[model samples]
Target: MDNYRPVSFWFDSLDDPVLDLREPPAQVDVAIIGAGFTGLWTAYYLKKKQPRLQIAVFEAETVGFGASGRNGGWCMGTATGIEHMLSVPSLQAEGIRLQQALENTVDEIERVCQAESIDCHFARGGTLNVAGTPEVAKRSQQWVEHLHRLGFKDSEYCWLDQAQSEKRIGLSRNLGAYYTTHCAAIHPGRLVRGLAEVNRALGVQIIEKAPVFNYTRVPDGSLLLSTGRGAVRAEKIIRATEGYTESIQGQQRSMLPLYSMVVATEPLSPEIWQEIGLTRRETFGDGRRVVIYGQRTVDDRLVFGGRAGYYFGSKRRALIPATDKAVKIVEASARELIPALRDPALGETVFSHGWGGLMGVPRHWRPCVTFDERSRIGWAGGYTGEGVGASNLAGRIMCDLVAGEKSDLTTLAWVDDVPRRWEPEPIRWLGVKSIEFFGDRADRREANNQSAGIWGSLFNRFVG
Candidate 1:
């Protein structure tokens, strides 16, 4: 219950030698910044393609310390909605291409673990996207129809009627649901640590706590990445920083660092688990304007997360505890859906962990990847709360770009610039809070209406 101590869950389980690079070398074939999924996967693919290439990764903190380690642990194959992508053609094409590329990321991740013989409790039981209201149910119906039209027959998403949804998810308030077979739940921290171990075994160099201060383009057409302790020069550089891209040269202040928070309950009794009827080990999220997501842990505990509130402040900020009102709302929602958990004798399950981290979001809510051919600098981010599988695909694309390959991965378009710039620091924080407040209100109003109609449109425009 102590903030979901993943270190205890993961560290004792690893069997590989830890590589702690104290200082950067003089030169390398590739230098990657950030050690999350994107950075680690980039190194993984690069090593597979060119085993002799000198690859080095620089991390500001320990590997997986960012969102990669702290995320909700859902590995979904699809990106955002196809309709949302179709509304923007450039992003639409990119979305299609990325979806195709990511079709195997979940499998690939599982394969990597199996090949390495790492046990992270990876399960491909699927995910349930439940509707919290009739309006949301309508949207889910439209989405199912849309996916069928897009030739996604193999997606394995079934339309669960209201009764079926409530019976399956133990949530009576849900109107309907869409079940997708393409998602998997992973121990995020273990996955990251395992990847780091595999990378080191493959001869990839990883340096932790090495914050990159600056980089210079040498006259020889190479990059010299300067860190606080040392420097490393490489022929090509890849920026894999997700929410923390603001620290890199030419990338600073280019991304909006939005915060997301999660809370995990204490392990439940076997009786409670049986009563909940969630034995399939699937993840769940309601289709509300302010969506809430929950998943059953391998250890019989339930983890839930949602928008903490409107945040208008620093990108690297943490979330405060839930207000009494918010806690009551969440607890009541849980009880309403799970009768087994309603008994007072079960005792109150205190939240063991409550933490928040930043994620990058562009104006259009599409993942962006940029390549500078002349400078040999490439970057990718802006997953918009759906980065798990998307980041893996981005990692592969980034490696392809660095290797100068003209593969299908490079066909995706990249946003030339970041979204809107906010006011400096303190003012930006206030603005975030105001936006969050407004967004929450709009979500509630739209959810109460049978048809979002004008109010829904307004909410979409504001968030967009």
Candidate 2:
């Protein structure tokens, strides 16, 4: 696999045909940069609300070429953790309202997918945060108490004991798990490609391979976007680029791109499936300081991923197919979580695919959706690793913000909440690397039944 580069299994399975616009119109009502979930969903809803408005989505590559196509396909409604939501004292009530709205978004996504006839193998099977270690179990219990105080009912989020957890997903080591009914599993590439088709059918122009170098305010109060090929001016511009935000000029500190690597095993045999089952297709993860996520693919493959490489300072970049070493770590971690998958009797632990992608992490660890009236610019991102469902909500919120319509989605907590810019240069690099190092150490300590020390407490209190 020397020549291997990071390409997601979802994208590999898709044969989504190229349907680039011949050229961007001389001018348009709205010009959106970055054709991932945010751009596609924004265009979809914007066109739905006002059919007469001309909309064009300009992509640096193709639609879903970024994190949209490469994610673990967890259509979870949570863009931030419960603790983060309650952080802002002034918006506590609004934050609760926002949580409810996110649950609604999950339903809305399914409704729209069905309406559009997009067969993305979407299953509302929910998610499980399993706790295999004592430290993780303690944390999981605390999280449940926190959720209960925040008024999440048993139907929405509930605790499952060891027996229940094992019965649900067949992972016996889990002392307990937090189960939520507000998430779904999806074939990300299929969903994004289907949305692109839906947008085109609705008269939205998708311009592929149009990398926007920069944008400037035009004399007439319009925005002029300079692409590698040419320039296009529009009345309003939406910066929907998430992980790729650094590529735009003068915005390097606006968002930090973190690499998440994934590996998927070949479809397990029927006997293996019986022994290690995720029968309901629930998304799974362990309660570790570092993020990890997995799901049972529709075709019976076990696709798992975790946070892997972190670049330093000016070196922040997207690593699509990450180094083989990083990918091996991800695969090994997955097997370690479920011993049956690594059993010698099962033969070689073969992974048919491995890939990586970048996700945007806000300096303050909060997702934001805002549109500036004075600048006629709209944007939404900073989902961390939770963009799958949040992008749909972002699109809906962006539609409301762009139209100057005061609606439920517009008044949400994350709207207009700008995070502080990251510190400059070496400081940023040092800070990020330190966090990653501490996170790995914490995970190791927990696995050994040791305490997480001061680093874990500091991270839990300060970082999301």
Candidate 3:
């Protein structure tokens, strides 16, 4: 396990195309802090809407350096949750509107991928929320009932029996599943790289390897972002630095950067594909309290990931560089979910890559997009681990907000939803550590066909 390489298989397999970089413009109409999906998509749509705007994207590493490139790659319309919708009555209407918008965003992603001729292996296979244990299967049924209570039709979300789940996922021990057609799988690294090029083609300047320290409000009412080389002034500044938000001064308590790890097996043979029949390559996860996600890559490899690393004090130690233990846990969970991988004869199932990255979790457990016109500062993030499709939505809404257009996007639930700061020090540390510990125990209990009890309920209320 110590010999495990920490590089992403996607990065290793593909030659990174050079990005068009120029010295950060002395001044620009807009300056974006991070060049991940949110920044790129915001630039892309902003330029598309108003071609004459001067936009510059600053990246500490490169495009998709964070979760954008290193995700399970499910373009799903699940950003808004029922609980978030019901958080308050005033938010209900906006949440419902946001939910519909997110569903449309899934289609918009396909539209953009086709229009740009981006060969990122975009597949329209749905998502299967499977249950590997009886307890989880019961919860899956409850989920279906909950959806029904919310006026959803069976066509939107349907419960599948054990045999049907096995037929779809080829996992022998699956107790049941909840299937939805509103999700797709894509090559994350390829998609984000292509997006950078598309934005560049549209006259967006991308400056890579330029780490942003902080921003200052200039006397002229513009924002100046301080970087290694020099300061770049802009009429508007966008903090698109999702998990890296803490790197900027005064924002450490804004969002929790949690590390999630992944492992990918080498390309399996045709016989192995037949045995592990993900014919449509649907993205999948189970009903455990500890989240795990997986997808069948375009090259016929299983790319699986899970959240097994949790560091307190908002340290985000998991993927600053992934620990060997975290990667091992993810690999083991993948094997546990799909027993076919444990077949001794399939020595070809050796893992070829292991990697980890950070996802931003808000203090209030809700995703948000906010812009303060007075400060000329805006940000869109905190999707937990569900930012792929949501980022596109965020980009569009941010464009509307920055342009001072009072459109429907501005009326969404997440707009200006600034959550409270995380508590100070040892209190914060103890709370987070306890939550993670209970989550692990809940997963084990569910795996043993037992209930998660109060701890699981607490987890759902806190971080679900």
Q: Which candidate gets the maximum TM-score versus the true structure?
A: 2
Estimate, for each residue in 14-109, the C-alpha lDDT of model 1 and write its tens digit: 443244756678899888888988899999999988999999999876787677876777888766443466446566665555566666778887
Clashes of each: 10, 2, 0
Per-residue alpha-carbon lDDT of model 2 for 129-205, expressed as tens digits? 99979988887788777778878888778888888888877564678898999899999989999999999999999
Alpha carbon deviation, residue 255, candidate 2 (Å)? 0.8
Query: For candidate 3, lDDT tens digit of each residue in 1-464?
Result: 12112447766566764644557889999999899899999999989999999999998777777788788889997784535573456766666677778878989999998999887898878899888888888877986887677666788778989888888886756777999887899988888888998988889999987878999987887788898658988999898988889989888888887788888888987777776777898999887667888999999999999975547666654233434788888988788768678877755488878888888878887778888888878999998888999999999999999888999888887889888988888887777778888888888887777788887887776775
lDDT of 2: 0.84
User: TM-score for each prediction?
Assistant: 0.87, 0.95, 0.94
RMSD of each: 3.7, 2.3, 2.8
Alpha-carbon local distance difference test for all models? 0.71, 0.84, 0.82
lDDT of 3 at 222: 76
Model 1: worst 10 consecutive residues (lDDT sum):
1-10
